[model samples]
Target: MTPSVPSSSRRARRRTAAVGVLVAAAVTAAFALTLDDSAHRDDTPDPSAVVTGSAAPPPADDSLLALARRDPSDALAVGRADAPVVMIEYSDFQCPFCRQFAQNTEPELLRSYVDRGVLRIEWRNFPVFGEESEQAALAGWAAGQQGRFWEFHDVAYGEPRERNAGEFSEEKLTGMAREAGITDIGRFQADMASDKARSAVREDQEEGFRLGVTSTPAFLINGRPVLGAQPVATFTEAVETAAKAAKAAGR
Candidate 1:
């Protein structure tokens, strides 16, 4: 004996199933949006950011490697123009991780690789911390006008300060320029306020955005992306690996 189910009961079950499916879809969509936002948010500091060890393969992007300007007279670059390895750094002066890298890892790279002409390091201003960050970057460029960019960089990242706490005021930047031995404070100020400085900073920021760099202290070692303030060894390894690869490619 077969008993037929009521049409109303069948319709009710179908409606409930449809609602469940819609809820599941909504939940999935929301989760995906969250992941997207977290990955691209510029202001959020990622705590888990660290040097990706040898286990993680380096990302490949020949275009990203081509971002190096390699100008011989470029004040923001150090090392040989045709070095086998070029490390392009996207950094913010006010970023804590950037400061960490500047204070800790960069000097080692300079001593071990840059001074030996095994690597070239290019600095790009990707200020995402706000007005003070932009001002500091401009100040750095201004110092570069007098061949004192690295000096200013050392002074700015010499100590840790509260982010955007007026540490980079116009007067402070002027003081830093003087500390970097700009010799001509007037010219430094003029350069800092010039349209050229702003344009230069904007270009760097745009390049970082284009490359999907939403965090400070991001780097491209021969086009391999290295995020966060990685340890000195991590940088050295990347540079060495890239140099080897470049040699093999006859680049």
Candidate 2:
């Protein structure tokens, strides 16, 4: 006859098993949720794929939704913190597709959803390009320290520039900060170089890596993974569907 396991030991083992299950699910979801390799490499590809989360309601304990911070004071976020739908954007500062989404689809979403308090948009700095990308991410966060993140974001994504070029040089970033209305240039520069800023950017980047994101402009809308710079209509439909689901479920 075998000895019975202690209750505490059994609970710990059960918890470990649960964590393992979630980890496996997240890894599988990441692969199933990413964009095509071609899209990541090019400026064009219609790059939209509605995966498992789109067609059906997400699980109540959606691991993807867990990624949403929903912090009201978050400078990189817009819309109501408790909005029925949340869109967590993972993007790189240097990616053309990211610029495409920012320039084209994002404005419309802001008008139709964010401004209307139906959706919340949280930004994740998932810089995958290289050193310049990292620097830009740090700059964006520094600007946010003074309530100028969106301003900086708009300026950075306003026009296309060659990747890894001098476009994101320190001097240029400082000029951009001034343009974005960050009053204290000294503080902004200091913040950009701070360990806090590096840690913040690193945290966002690691989150993206954990999700197996291999490209820019990825998103999780209400826990439904919508990869790449999808069309405005795709985002619109996703938001509307999520809002309706949230209401029906009394969320």
Candidate 3:
């Protein structure tokens, strides 16, 4: 060598090279894991895809199941208070996926599970689309005050419309209420603008946000997360599984 390298210097160089290799290996492994996760997510069915059929397994966090407010008298809910399964729905009035569930899968659940006392349905207004969506949610709550919430819900989701269009204007909402058999339009209007209605909507929105619900038509069946407007079979299976589990747990 041109100059004799100190032994300490040689050892330091070796250590530095070893550390660099370890760092590179760690980074490459981390990247591989990230890519694997992304691939899995990409393979999963898109929630907004046309709901011909799909079923996602329950999420690990069971906190979502606690969303069900099982008050028998709750106007925004239906089915037995002690039903084996409670299905809580987070929905937007202007969401087309919500409409798809309402028009297609919901009726089947009503017939098989709700009517059979195997399931309960609780509705939460989660209007993420904007002003019209919020207005429609408030209108729905107002209709519930007059015992016409379901009727209003049917009218609102009975057909599809352009998002944020004039479909949910104040005048149109009143007409829908009338169609839903709400005789007292005056009281409905008053309730729609009341602090109570706003508070109720805010509470539901907070709950959705807390649970990280970023989309409409999200669901919790006995605390199991069933996202999107999945098919009727998906609901049936969820309901059946939940019912069995509830029975096993003596719930």
Top-TM-score structure, candidate number: 2
Model 3: per-residue Cα lDDT over 180-248, one tens digit each: 999999999999999999999999998777666666677778766677667787888888988888888
In candidate 3, which residue pairs get closer than 3 Å at backbone N, Cα or C atoms, i.e. clash? 65-223
Number of clashes in model 1? 0
lDDT leader: 2
Residue runs of model 2 more than 4 Å from their true location after superposition: 5-28, 31-39, 43-61
> Model 3, stretches more than 4 Å misplaced?
1-64
* Cα lDDT of model 2 by residue, 1-251, tens digit: 99987799899999988986886476546535535565566533343432222233233334556678999999999899999899989888888888888888999999999999999999999998899899999999999999999999999988777888788999999999999999999999999999999999999988777766667777878777677666788889898988998899887
**Residue pairs with clashing backbones, model 1:** none
- How does each model score on lDDT? 0.79, 0.82, 0.78
User: How much lDDT does candidate 2 score?
Assistant: 0.82
lDDT of 1 by residue, 104-196 (tens): 789999999999988999999999878999999999999999999999999998876677778899998898888888899999999999999
User: Model 1, which residues run further than 4 Å from truth?
Assistant: 1-57
TM-score of every prediction relative to native: 0.78, 0.86, 0.78
RMSD (CA, Å), each prediction: 13.3, 3.7, 13.0
Candidate 1, run of 10 with poorest lDDT: 27-36
